[model samples]
Target chain A: MRILVTVKHVPDLQSQRSFTGGRVTRTADDGTMNELDEHAVEAALQLVEAAGEGEVYALTVGGADAVVAVRKALQLGVQHAIHVSDDAIADSDVFGTAKVMAAAVRKVQDEAPLDLVITGMAALDGLTSMLPTALAAELDWSQATLASAVSVAGGEVTVERHLADAHETVVAPLPAVVSVTDEANKPRYPNFKLIMAARKAPVALWSLADLGVDPASVGREGARTVVVDASPAPPRENRVTVTDTGDGGTQLADFLIEKGLA
Target chain B: MTTVAVLIDHRDGEVTRPALEALTLARSLGTPVAVWLGSVPSADAVALVGDYGATEVRVVDAEMRLAGHAAAALGAALEDADVVVVISTFVTKEIVTRLAMATGAGVVVDAAGAEIVDGRVETVQTVFAATWNVRTRIHTERAIVGIRPNTTQAVPADTPGDAVIVPVTVDRPATRERVVAVEPVERGAGVPLAEAPVVVSGGRGTGGDYALVTELAELLGGAVGASRDATDEGWISHEHMVGQTGTTVTPALYVAAGISGAVHHRGGMQASGTIVCINLDPDAPIFEISDFGVVGSLFDVIPQAIARIREHRAG
Candidate 1:
């Protein structure tokens, strides 16, 4: 019943997000754990608690500040945390990121068998929604993604996928990868005791060399995609403001009629 | 001419509009070859592909799963093609990623338009929650691109409809995820949010009462949408949320009632043709983008507007 949840450290969406030199300019000052990943951690913790004898570990890959994501997970009741950071891992595309994460998961498995790997539906920054499948391909495990609800029993994992058009139930065997949506659970706020403990917890740090990964196969050099050009969106203009002088609705209806939109 | 492979998504032998849009976009770059993943292509499906300017349709008789296997199937078949075009969906995103991994090609998702520039495939993406448009080129010999639906209108081209049955070896690893059941959600009756020509959205200003919003949407024959705040408060489902993280919509007319219009929510509906806003706050950000603004309470404004529209229609 041991589970590993993948978390990410991303720039807060409320901040002014921009790109520089054909790359996303992420400032560590405003970065925090991806909001969606909270559901993954919550789901894993619930599963472990329900089973009564298991552990939940949180894993993240980013720069030094990324350890904050793992620390956040520990505060949510996860037992162990691992952070894989290397200078060469910067600007790694989705494929390279998946490779590094898969390698790290394997390394973790060597110490203890992993029954499940969980992740959020998508990172707020990239919004790719491709990592869970890529990691499943790398680990050669079954994958169920975008699950709104999940339950594991009898060496099988079942999930309800809440797609735009329909709701579907999907099932995969044990040792599978699954990505949960924000509707999966409400993440509990860390208690004062756990919050203090998390600040003091030692986060295991691993390097690319430690994972036996070739530096040349990842990072900017290994990325397949390139941003040729970027530009800001044109500013919106030509707005007409109307004050409600008791006939505002009449004016609005007239405006819609004038535009042939009513 | 370079060969462009377009994945044709269909259901029960009917070609979806997004698939036709993909084919139309593919035809702009090079010779388009439609790759049908399901059962043998029916006559109507072949004709539809031809109308979208596909030179030839390649039918792959395989049960495609959302898992990475469908990408493997297409990747194996598209070895000779220069570019692969797929509709950007939850399933196709993963397929495109797998295709890139298998072929050592770069991949782009959510592209609004794509064309060959300087002998390289260039894709324009609406990034930063649709606040910016970034042009990118995959630095590879071959490229896989995921085009968002409604990015461009599907235009017909003169072509001789031809079909080819290609036997594909799907080199998919053992599937990790399997769909056991599919239940249709009960949405009652209304145009789908993505396909509707008009959308009426409410926000936190609704104060947990979507009655006015839904009524106005029904009167307008449009879809009902909600801001993230409303959805977060359990007033509506996340699917109906229109924002950066929710459904991006481009409709002819969008009515914002009680929405203060945060940047994230504005990103989803800014592409709409005409916008109308009704809010108590005159200084709401929504007023900046709206073509018509009514500074009043939605509870007071919506009912009057709806009644006037109905009366006008009856006349």
Candidate 2:
């Protein structure tokens, strides 16, 4: 079995993000692979490890810095890495980004077919949670997004999807795609030994042309939506009251009575 | 006309309020068509389609009934549609993404609004967890989108029309996974979270005591919310949990008692129109975003607030 994992490099969402003149300003802050993408990568690595005979490939699209994200996946024991890089790929929204990724996956599969394609349910930056579905649409494959758990055996892929109100168990045939949620599994941090090994691992960098994609076919231009504005959320006002500590239950009852709610 | 497919989720025969919100949004996009899966809904449900501005309604036979994967039904219903609009629920997101994948459509999840732009559907999104706003215009042959709840106020109409019910065939792919069981937790008698104008939440300071929170919620004619810590401690059911891992609520008024205002908790409730925090420590994190801050114990503050509410109501 062959597995493909899609990873993304996003600004560390933990840090405060500011914009200047309708564009996001870069911070001198440290960043890492998206946390959700890490979960997807870890899940793919786990499945490959359990199967013991399948190959895992890391795929990412971004600037030269995205190679760092691809290497992180290699450190987790993926067999190889594919970095889709180009200046033309910048500012791609979830829709356009997924289109580029789908093209890359098709190119890779043209050489070696895959049993499964995996991605994080969403990235924290935009938190659109649309990539997996958009890619699934482009690939014309069965999809299970927000996968809480996934298992592969024989030629079938089974997934437990976490829903708004309940859990759904679904099974799609081989060559299916899944978008993993945070609840799937915690991502592993690379140890010094694995990091050293990853340095020697093969990470093929491909431009959009190498993947046979037209330069005009993707990125922000391909996106359906453009952000026109961003501003700090409105600050809330406070109107709270303090209660006496003694006899809280009775006070609570009295408070309800005073409020005319009891 | 741009065919806008509206995915409706119903209980028995009643449409969920959020679905109605989606219908209201779908109307803004193009010709709104309502799609019902599983059992055919009641006449009231059909009536609601017309009332909410749905020009057509299609019913598809679902092999795995009881609110199964909405994407599957939506995918089947998109036989002749230009765009699809599904309500953003935890379940619908999973289905819409999958269906969008199989159909080669541009998929945008959790859009706040939509409009026709340059002969295409443009959607406004709340990105970066509501930190940034974006507008997307889809020029694809087909598009799939999900919309947030309460983004649009549902305007009920009196136009009576019939749903063009269509029977869709089911193609159950042979697979090993099976639906073991379906269990429902009784949502007990209270104002629905989406409909409630106010919400009162408790956190670690409550020490697992929710009596005051409930009282304040009732006083405000709202719902009770719990911090992740309180929910994890079993002080309240997980359904009441309000934080990063919990439900995001945007009510007209939100009151926090004993909560220390963890960012995770604030992420879910920060969108509320107004926020009030009551804590012994004035420096608690909750106070930073609160419109009204009272430095005191939850025990003392909640009761007094309740009393004031009663006094105002009586007058």
Candidate 3:
């Protein structure tokens, strides 16, 4: 089995986040591998282990700082790391990003036929949950998303997809794109040996030219939707906080009644 | 006026609140057309669509439980639409993505609302975990927009629509995926979380005992929600989780019980109209955004609140 897991470098959830130029401001200092992608990395690693003879490739797209994402993937034992970075790749929308990802996947396929592509259900920073589908569409591969449980056998990938009303077991052909939810598995922590080796690991750096994806077809110029305005939400007014003096609940009820919210 | 297609979401022959909400939003954009995928809709369902100002109901009889298949069937009905609107859900987002890919339309998901600004679809959404409001315009002719539930209030049209029924047929694309089996999940009695006007959620503070949280929700006729902490602890099903990556709720009243209101938790419910919190720790971040906050154990405060509500009803 040969699998490529897409990872992202994202602002830590605990840190303050803001948007500049109508895009998320990314600084090298405070970013880490997206928390959710760990589950994707775990899924890919587990699948490789189950097959007993396979390769797991972790790939990311960003500027120089995004190498950290693939390095973190290496700490979890991915055999290869590739970072696709370019000056022209900034401000890319989901479609633009998907185009870049499809190119990178094809480059890897050139090395050897890849059996599967895995990604987290959603990126922590964007939370758009659109890339897996768009990438599959770009690659014209079968897509299975939001998988709570996944298994591969006989060139077919099966996933237990959870929905609002029902749980569905979906089956798709190999060379497909799959996105796994956090419920798929408990991500394993990086051990001391793996963490040390990750520091010295070699990462393959690619550009839009390397993947043959047009620079004009990605980045801000290729974006189909443009953010016109962005601003912070104004704070709520007339906030009242009360300490419990044995009547806190009554006070809450009175407040609710006053607002007709009870 | 351009055609604005609203994908009607229904189950068991009844329409969901979000679908009506989508139609309500659609009416503002242009000629509202309701797209129904599956067997023929019941008369009441068709009327409900018209009541919300859908000028036409185009039913595509097919099996679309899987998004990959649904996207293919949906593409045909959307050919004439300038904008495609659907209630943003896990399944529908993928469907919208495929539709956009097929038609070369710009797409936006998790949007709060969409409007035609100067002959193009402009979408308003809360991003960066609901801390920021963003306005984005689609550059393409057809825009696939996925609006979150409960963001727009559903109002019937001034003059009810003359919903002309149109049957649509499209060759189902040879999709690469198929659903082999489906199992229904049982949910507790209450309003669905996404559409509930009042949401009462518990967290680590509940200590695995949701009796009080569930009681408070039941008292208010609200849905019971959970912080990622509680859901991760297996205290509640993932469906009940209210967080950034989980279910985002914009209820009229959101009551956080024992949740510390991390950015993840806050992103989901901060858009609510009224916020209240009960936490033993006075310093919990949830208090910052709350209109009313009580520094006390949820166990004690919830029972008291529930009792007062029951008493208020009796009086």
Candidate 4:
């Protein structure tokens, strides 16, 4: 089996995140692989290990900082890494990004026929949860998303999706795209040897030209959506702090009663 | 006037609250048209949609499992609408994204507010794990927007709606994914977390004992939630985790017990109407966003609070 896992570098959730000129002002200094994408890498690694005769490749699309995402995947036991970066790809919306990613996936498929592609349920930064479906549409491939568990056999892929009301078992043919939720598996930590090797490993860098994508068809120019305005969230006010004073529970109950909440 | 299409989400012929919220928002943009998929809207569901300001109801007869056919059904029903609104659920997000890609329309997800400004559809998005609120506009003439629940209350327009059954044929491809089975996850609970009006959440301070939290939730007819730390410690399942990475919830009242109020946890419950925090540390960050807070041990305070509430209810 030949599998490719996609990862993304996002601004750390704990950092102070903001936007400028309607674009996210990414704090690359604090950027890291999307926490959810780790599950995708772990799933791919596990699949390869289970097959005992397959290779796992990591792919990322973003600016230079995005290579950090690929490197992180490599450290998690992926054999090969590819980073697709170009100035023209900046500020691409989900649709533009999906187009570029689909093209890059096709380029990789040319080198090695892939049997499966895996991605996180959603990218932390965008949180759209739309990329898997959009990329599948662009690639004309079947997709099973938000899977809590995944298994591949007999030229088919089956997944158990944990939804709000029900746990669904979904299935698709081989060469399908699957997105795993964080509950799928626990990501393994990179050992010292793997960490050192990942630091030294070379990652192939591809641009829009390399992927046969038009510069005008990507980036801000190719974006289907535009941000008209952006501003800081208004500060929350009217917070009331109360001391325990040995009657905290009574006070809380009275407050709830007053508000008709209890 | 331009028409705004709102996808009506329903289960077993009951209109959902989020769908009503979406319809309310849709009315602000233009004439609200409620689009129902999978099943025909019952008379009461139609009347409810009308009460929520839907001027017309379009029903597309299809199975819920045929999700791939949804985009086409919606496209055919909403071909004339300038903007489309959908509730931000997992299935709707996929259908709306596919429709947007197919039509080359701009798509916005998790919008808290949407309106027509200067002849363009402008939307407010809570991004960066709800740390920043950015207002965006779609350049394209047609746009798709997914609105989160509880962004606004569903208001009645008091206008009866006209119903139409639109025939749609989905050119589904041969190699699409299929749902083989759906098993409902059972929880020891009063209500589903997403649909619960009140939620009581526990944290690391619970010390792997959710007994108190669960009891309070059940007493109040609410749902139980857990912080990531508690779930990570195996005190509860990840399904109960409320954080940026977990489920984003918006309840009428949210009670955080023994939680430190990490940004991640706040992202999930910040949209709730009334936030109450109980913790031993006065300096804990959870107190900042809380509308009401008490500096005390949850173990000591919760039992008393529960007893008081029970007594008050009985009287």
> Which ten contiguous residues of candidate 1 chain B have the minimum total lDDT?
B160-169
Lowest lDDT block of 10, candidate 2 chain A? A235-244
The DockQ value obtained for model 3 is 0.80
List A-chain TM-scores for all predictions: 0.94, 0.86, 0.98, 0.95
Model 3 misplacement above 4 A? none
The DockQ scores of all candidates, in the order shown, are: 0.56, 0.29, 0.80, 0.65
Instruction: List runs of model 1 lying over 4 Å from the truth.
Output: A250-262, B63-65, B158-174, B187-191, B206-221, B229-238, B262-264, B270-274, B283-285, B288-291, B303-315
CA lDDT of B273 in candidate 2? 64
Model 4 clash pairs are none
Local accuracy of candidate 4 as per-residue lDDT tens digits, B1-315:
868998887865888877888888888898888888866667788878888777678877755553467887888778888899998877888888888977888889888889888887889877764556788878889989998877867887766565454544545435477788988777653656766788999998888888999898888778899999998888887778887667787888899999999877888888787889899999999998888899999988888888888889899
- Estimate every model's Cα lDDT from 0 to 1: 0.84, 0.72, 0.90, 0.84
Tens digits of per-residue lDDT for model 2, A56-174? 88998888777777888888778889999998877676656777888889888988899889998766565656677667767767666677798988787788764545556767677
* Number of the candidate with higher DockQ, 2 or 4: 4
Candidate 3 chain A least-lDDT 10 residues: A12-21
Residue-level lDDT for B40 in candidate 2: 75
Candidate 4 residue runs with Cα over 4 Å from true position: A257-262, B162-175, B187-191, B207-221, B230-239, B307-315
Shift in Å, residue A243, candidate 2: 9.9
Give lDDT tens digits, candidate 3, residues A46-117.
Answer: 998999989999999999999999999999999999999998899888999999999999999998999899
Residue B252 Cα positional deviation in candidate 1, in Å, after optimal superposition: 4.5
